[model samples]
Target: MTPAPAGLTCRLCGRADLRSVLDLGAAPPCQRFMTADQLDEPEPGLPLHLRLCADCLLLQIPPLLSPADNFTDYAYYSSFSSSWVAHARRFVERAARELLPADAFVVEVAANDGYLLQHVAARGIRCLGIEPSENCSDAARRRGVPVHTAFLDKATAERVRAEHGPADLVIANNVWAHVPDVVGFTRALATLVAEHGRISIEVHHALSLVRDAQFDTIYHEHFQYWTVLAAERALAVAGLRLVDVELLPTHGGSIRLWAVPAASDVPVSGAVARVRQLERTAGLDTPAGYQGLAPAVGQIRDGLLRLLLDARAAGQRVVGYGAAGKGQTLLNYAGVRPDLLAWIADKNPYKHGRYAPGTRIPVVDVDRIEQERPDLILVLPWNLREEITGQLSGVGRWGGRLVFAQPRLTVIDPGAAAIEGAA
Candidate 1:
C-alpha cells in the first residue's frame, strides 16, 4: 500500500500512527471566494482525506493551506447569523457572571467582528481580541473591541501576556478546529491564562457530526473534528484540566469546554464525566466509531444532486441561499456547477459579486432571489434552516420553496406542507 501523505501526524497527539477513515476527494479552500476576473483560469484543489489517530482517537485532516493563505483577509463575518450573535451575547452574559468579574481581563481568540467580545467589552471588562484576519480584526476594532491582528501561538501569547498581564479569561470559540498546530494553540492558551484563570474552548462535537451525518462540515479549514475524549487528552498534555463541558445547539451541535490549570484545586464537574462517558459509549475512541460517515456522506451527495437535476429537468429554477464554507464543500464534492446551481444569494456585501471557489457559482445579494424568484431556493447552511426558512418565508407568496440538503435533502414548508425530497 502507498504511504499516507507526509505530515499526516495527528494535530493534537503528534502521532504518525494514523489510519485513513474517509476521503471526500480533492476540494478547494473553503473560504477562497473568487472574483469574476479569476474564474476563467484553472482552479486548484487539494486532497481532503480524513485520518484517525489510534493513540488519541482524534479525527483530523492534514493542513493543506497555511494560516496566512486562509485567514489574512477572510470573507466570513461572525455576525451574519442573528442566532449566532445572540448565542455569543448569551455566552458573554454567563461568562461575565461565572468566569470573570468586571474590570478583569478577557481575551478572545479568532474573535471576528467583535461579535462576542463586544458584549464582554460592553460590561466594563478589559477585553482584547486576537484575530489573524485583517479585514475582520479591523471591523472588530471599529466596533470598539481592541484586537491584535496575529495568529495565537506561543510567541504571540507571550507578547499579549507581556502587554496586558495574564488574562483572567481566554476564549477560544470555534477556532481550535482551524489551528494547524492545535497543541501549540492549546499551549498558548495555557501561557496567556492566569494561574487561576479559565479557558473556554468551543468545538463542534465529533460524535454529533457522525450521529447526524453532518459530513459537509468537513472542510479543509477545519483541521480537526473533536471528541471530548480527544480534547481531554490534548488539554492534559498542555497542563490544563477539563473542568466542565456544556453541549450547545449552535453550529449544528457543539460543546463548550472549560479548562483550568492542572494544579488548580477546582473539582472536575460531573458534566465532564457525563460527556466523556457518552462519547465512549458511542464508541468514539475506537476505529469502529469512525466507520459510519462515508456511506451517509455518499447518500447525501447523491440525494442533493438528484434533487437539483430533477428540478432542472422539470423546468424549475434553483438558486442557493448562502455561499457558506460548508456549502462550498457540499457543492464541490457533489459535483455541482453553475449549470446546475444558477446563483447563490448571500447577505455579506464582501461575498456578493464574488464567485464560489470551485463551482464558480455567482454570489449575489438577496435581491437576486427577489428579482428572479426561482422556483426552489437551496439553503446551503442547513444548520440555520429554521432561521433561513423564516427569513425567506415570503417566498411562499410566489409559490417558491426552501430546501436543505444535510442529513438528506428535504423541502421545508412552514404551513404544515408535506416535506418533499428526491424519489
Candidate 2:
C-alpha cells in the first residue's frame, strides 16, 4: 500500500518490490543510550517498521539512522551477560581450530567489549577487532584486543587491512542483518578477507522467524531478516560463496554460516543442501509465502491485545517482564502504556531503572515482580519465556499468571499450571 513507503526496499537486491508487514511507529534507536541529563532533552526517533520482498526472502525496514552515528557511540556491552562471554569464548576457541590459518590474523567486526577477541588473543592468535562503539572499543583495548573505533565500511575495511594486515578469519556475528548498505558491507567483507580466507556470519533467520510469528524482533536497528537463500543471492553478487552453514540454538533460532571467495572449489557442505531443501519446502521464494506473513503477524498482535483487554476487564493487574529491544518494539507496536503494564522488569542493571523505548514503560528489577505479585505478568521477551517462568515459579502463589506477548496472549495459571496458550 502507498508504494510500501520509500523507506521500504529490499536490503539485498535493492529491489523496490517491498510490502509492509509490520509497522512499529516512532521508536527511539534500540541501542542508543543517553546520560541521565540528556534524557530531559528531545531524543529523536523514527518509525520502527518492517517489510518483506516477494522476489527474495528478505524482510527489512527502512534505514532511518546511519550505523556510523548509532554504532560508533554504541552503548551496548556484549559481555554484560556472563553467558554471552562464555558463548564468545567457545566460538573463538572453535574458530581458531577450524578457520584460523596457522599464524594468519583474525578480525571481528562489531567486536563488542572484546568478548570474542579476548578469547582469540588468549590463544596467541594474531587478532584485531573493528568496533564502532568508542566506549566498547576502549573496553576491548583494555582487554588487550586492539580495536579500530569506526564503523566498517569499504574505506574502513581498506584501512583495517592496511593497518592490521588482511585477516585469515573474519567473524561478524549478529550484525549481518543490521546494516542498510548490505552491498557495500559485503563487498568490504570480500575486500578485507585474505586470499581463500573464511568469513563467518550469524544472523536471525527470516524463514524461521516468520514461520514462528516472532514479530517482536522487528525494530529500527535490525534492517533485515536474512535467510540462507537470500544471503546466497547477495553473496553471489559480491563474488563470494557460502562454503557451509549451521543452524544454532542461539537467539531463538539463528543461522551461523561460513563463506569464502567464489573461486574456491571446496565442496559445499551438506548443511547448505539441507537449508536449500528447507527453503523450498517453506516456499520462501514464492509470492504465496510472502502473502501469508502480514496476516499472521496481525493475528498475533490482535490476539494479544484482546487477551490484555480481557484481563483488564476482569480487574487483573498486569505487569511486563524483560525490557529487551524486542520488548520495546512489541510494546510500542501494541500501543501498550503504563496502564496496561504497571512496569517492566529486566535483569540488566543499565536498563532496570530506565523506560522501555517509546512506550516509556518503567523498568525495574525482578524483585519488583515478586513484590507486586500482579495477577498477570507479561513476558515481553517471548524468546526467554520458558527460562523466566521456571525461575519465577514462586510468584504465582498469589494467583499471579504468566503471559507471553508473542503468538497471541495466553496466560499460564497462577500456580504455574499449564493453561491456554502454553507454548
For TM-score, the strongest prediction is 1
Ten residues in sequence with the least summed lDDT for candidate 1: 1-10
Show model 1 residue runs off by greater than 4 Å.
Answer: 1-7, 415-418, 421-423
TM-score for all models, in order of appearance = 0.97, 0.88
Instruction: For candidate 1, list the clashing residue pairs, or say none.
Output: none
> Per-residue alpha-carbon lDDT of model 2 for 210-258, expressed as tens digits?
7777877777778888888889988988899998999876666789888
Per-residue lDDT of 251 in model 1: 78
Tell me the RMSD of model 2 versus the true structure: 3.0
TM-score of 1: 0.97
Alpha-carbon lDDT, every model: 0.88, 0.78
Per-residue lDDT tens digits for candidate 1, residues 223-329, read 89999998998999899999999999877899999999999998999999899888888878788787887888888888888889999999999999999998998
Candidate 1, residue 146: how far the Cα is off, in Å: 0.6
